[model samples]
Target: MGDENRTGMTEFYFRPFSSLPKVQLLIFLILLLMYMVSVCGNGTIVLIVCTDCSLHTPMYFFLANLAAMEICYSTIIAPLTLANLTSLRKATISLAGCGIQMFFFIFLGGAGCVLLAFMAYDRYVAICHPLRYTIIMSWTVCVSIVAASLALGFLVSLNMTILIFHLPFCGTNEIYHFFCDIPAILHLLACSNTHAHQVALYICSVINVAIPFLLICFSYAFIVVTILRISSGAGWHRTFSTCSSHLMVVALMYGCSSFIYLRPSSSYSPEQGRVVSVVYTFVTPVLNPLIYSMRNKELKDALSRALGRKVLHQSK
Candidate 1:
């Protein structure tokens, strides 16, 4: 019905949230503050990782890449959202721009999800097979894993974006939420039967979100078993502390993402979706990098040394 009607319809408008100007301004400020925090937090991690030779381990390497991804991931969605919040009623994104946003949104997001699982595996190997940790997680293997994760993420995002924009948008051009979310577009906006599209989305979500989460869980199961066998007394806390940061990140990423993507579009509530999207998009990106670098003693020590060196350079 909408194929021809949608041919020239190359723009999508974002609907306003709060009718009150004060409320909109408040939201904008808060979002901007959080976005800045996310950028600095992730940016610090990247800087320290690259500068500090002590943090050149595989885990920190992955952490640096993950931080870089968060910085980019949030930038992809947050600025546009902040702008929308300020304007309140009149914000429009071109069709191509929207598709590009969706592509990187999924690419970085899916890659980050998979990278978490790999980090879990790194913990697993270091704990379960301590003697072979070096061999098992070789630099070559880590780089390859990261490369594969990105390639796979890119391919999946490309396919999803193409399928989505290919649909006819002959009807309402108003998006109910901040960005071009898959369900928001597929269910509410696309003027076509989305049975096949929904199925594809569901399958990808399972592969990207569910499967990686399960893998993390599986790896952690072995990690717990191995930790219990080797440590007791005060050793228990010390042994588990290394993984606690990662586990928290896993919980946050999977919990919010699953809530957002792991369901049928028929049950998608626009209000609820926007609220939850804030968590994974804004909150997690801020917290994940902080927890990894800020909370880790080794990274902290490295940062201290870097600061010491910086101060010495300035003094000299």
Candidate 2:
């Protein structure tokens, strides 16, 4: 009995549908609504960016890119989470399924971090050195920065997933979070993974959270300095408005990410981690388009034009 209890079965069983209660339908409906809003909001941002030629500037270019990334980022886990919530039959993901989800999650998320850092730098260049902005943010430089961000994201995610999944999950395989996260996955490992795993987690922290954070902080610091240097009060106000939306986004992403990943696992409960993950994973995506695009005068104009065109077509 002791041996059997100590050594969990390789093929884990999930709870049956019959065992679950009826109120889970309410939870499913709420999750579905959240997923729909996230998808629609990000989708609208992509459409608005592509359609508006006036928004072809570097800031809008990166904004579109960020919107695309948000779409991918939310897709990585929202559907699965909603499905799991609704199924009544709380199914268990195979090890391979979990790994694939983990890969996409980290890939898009890490890339977004790097991309946000690049965007901050872009904003800094635009505001701080407006006269030389064109020369500084050349086509080649922009492409290279974006490419580098994507490549770095893929490389880091690949390595982290490989390292994490290679660990033998010989124990009970119930992931606490709605998705596969590093610390949550670590909690289910049968064997002791003390020093080496901690090192890997630390490295992930530096790459995913710390380094990007420092870059964002430094860029914002420069931006604030540059804003203060502007001679006209109107100029200062305009520049500050241009960045406030992005500042809000950076604060949300970094604040949640820092709390979720940077802390010692012992300090928090898995339940708390799940709730925090929702902020960045679901809420951020839903809020981003509303925050960034809705605040912009050009986007509102384009949206109005698009709506008018649709109305005319219907009349025709």
Taking the tens digit of each residue's C-alpha lDDT, what string does model 1 give over 47-141? 99999888888989889999999999999999999888877358899988999999999999999999998999998998888899999999999
Model 2, 1-316: lDDT tens per residue?
1243234433333322223455556656766777788888878878877887877777887888888889888888877776776664666776667778888888888888888998999998998788999999987888888788889889988988887766666655566678887777776553555557767877887897789889988999999897777889899778877888888898998899888778876775777787898789888988888887666777778878888998999999
Candidate models: Cα lDDT each: 0.87, 0.78
Using TM-score as the measure, which candidate wins? 1
TM-score of 1: 0.96
* Per-prediction TM-score to the true structure, in the order listed: 0.96, 0.91
lDDT of 1: 0.87
After TM-score superposition, the amount by which residue 293's alpha carbon in candidate 1 deviates from its true location, in angstroms, is 3.3
